[model samples]
Target: MAEMILTRELFRHMCEEQEKLDTHIYRTRETKAPSLKSLDIAYTNEANEAIKELQKDWKWWTLKERNRERFIKEVADCFHFVASMANQTRTVGYCYAAIDHEYQKVSRISRECYPHEDIFYKAVKGTVQESIASLIAISEALGATTDEIMTAFEDSLKKNYGRMATGY
Candidate 1:
């Protein structure tokens, strides 16, 4: 519970980078409208994928080992959708514009949020910030250090670029 090392500045930069991936995603593949609701559902689905990765160890009867790397990758994917969600709002402005007041709220909620401690199917009344909090909760639950999460994000971006190259 120490202060999160992932500062808002870094978070914004990460979002910008994710925007590149999202651009490729739209160009190389069909995508839902860049609407908040669409992004919210997409982000929630990615969160569930992260949970699926975490559940690899849930079945005591199985000998499967949870892959930290894959779980972190899924968490990173959550951010990808988050950044897209941000773009739909002029207030958040994908963290490009000054959101000092808004970010204060987002930071607090993101840090304190564990509203859904179980499998998250959908957000009842989700916003971009709430979705971000959920993503943070998943990262914390999986014990993924901020550094690891950032690295996974970078890797995901690279993979997205590769996917674009191959028409994925």
Candidate 2:
């Protein structure tokens, strides 16, 4: 008699286990919001908080575990909000596209314009604001409320953080 291998079934089982782990991790950190509006508020606030922290020099210090943890948590929080909002808004893909537009503008300006600090800041800020507004409109078009759109934005940020952390 020959021994039989079940490699395909084994791979499926492993994938299922990994999914469960992902769900467990998500559930452990997620906070419940009764309405989509609340989720959006949470997303915007959390993103703001993360930006503040990122601006701090202490945030970049490797010795500060608390700061690192806080950064990670804030990003994760933003992610949750975004996911909820995207699902509600149906504008997830469009929002990402808008972000790309802003990034491209920034890059173009960075290369064409001389290294002027104030001008760079103005350009980047203006572009980001425009992108956000356009994304908001897109989200609304998808039948999403303001809150949902904000949440989706946060979720996009979180996904980006994950990629950075993993060096992907």
Candidate 3:
């Protein structure tokens, strides 16, 4: 299959849609406030959830059976929150650029490396945090293809657009 590409326009729209969904849901709940917490807290929590999904104490052979779908969903959730955080901070462009750049680096490494080698760890380059590097690595280790991630993002954007304006 041809590689899936996420353009800046799509990223912006996804973030906008997610924000709208958040607003609508919060408004409909009546008691829940609309203001999102600090991005640091949100990102950390989402990343932790993704990590937990991957860290299920199953045998290596059973890992796919036990955690694949949940892990993918958690990764998607991370993307959603990350996009929202970027939008809130007016840094969506930077966020997209960074992700795209890192993704290209990973792709190049994957193309050049042996399958059994630790491509993820090897893909890490200057200035990238250990945690972020791990995330990029784990994403590949889990077989989360770029196309799959892009599809999840697009689906999320559509879902968010379907929500009521006040989140109801």
Top lDDT model: 1
Better of 2 and 3 by TM-score: 3
TM-score for each prediction? 0.66, 0.37, 0.57
TM-score of model 1 vs. true structure: 0.66
Best-fitting candidate, measured by TM-score?
1
Local distance difference test, candidate 1: 0.60
Model 1 agreement with the true structure over 41-110: per-residue lDDT tens digits? 8877776676566554444466667676777788788777766666556333444333333334344543
**1 versus 2: better TM-score goes to:** 1
lDDT of each: 0.60, 0.41, 0.55
**How accurate locally is residue 43 in candidate 1, as Cα lDDT from 0 to 100?**
78
Candidate 3, residues 41-86, lDDT tens digits: the string is 5555655665556443322444543366665565566667666666
After superposition, the stretches of candidate 2 with alpha carbons farther than 4 Å from their true spots are 1-34, 57-69, 106-168
TM-score of 3: 0.57
Task: Point out the higher-scoring one by lDDT: 2 or 3.
Answer: 3
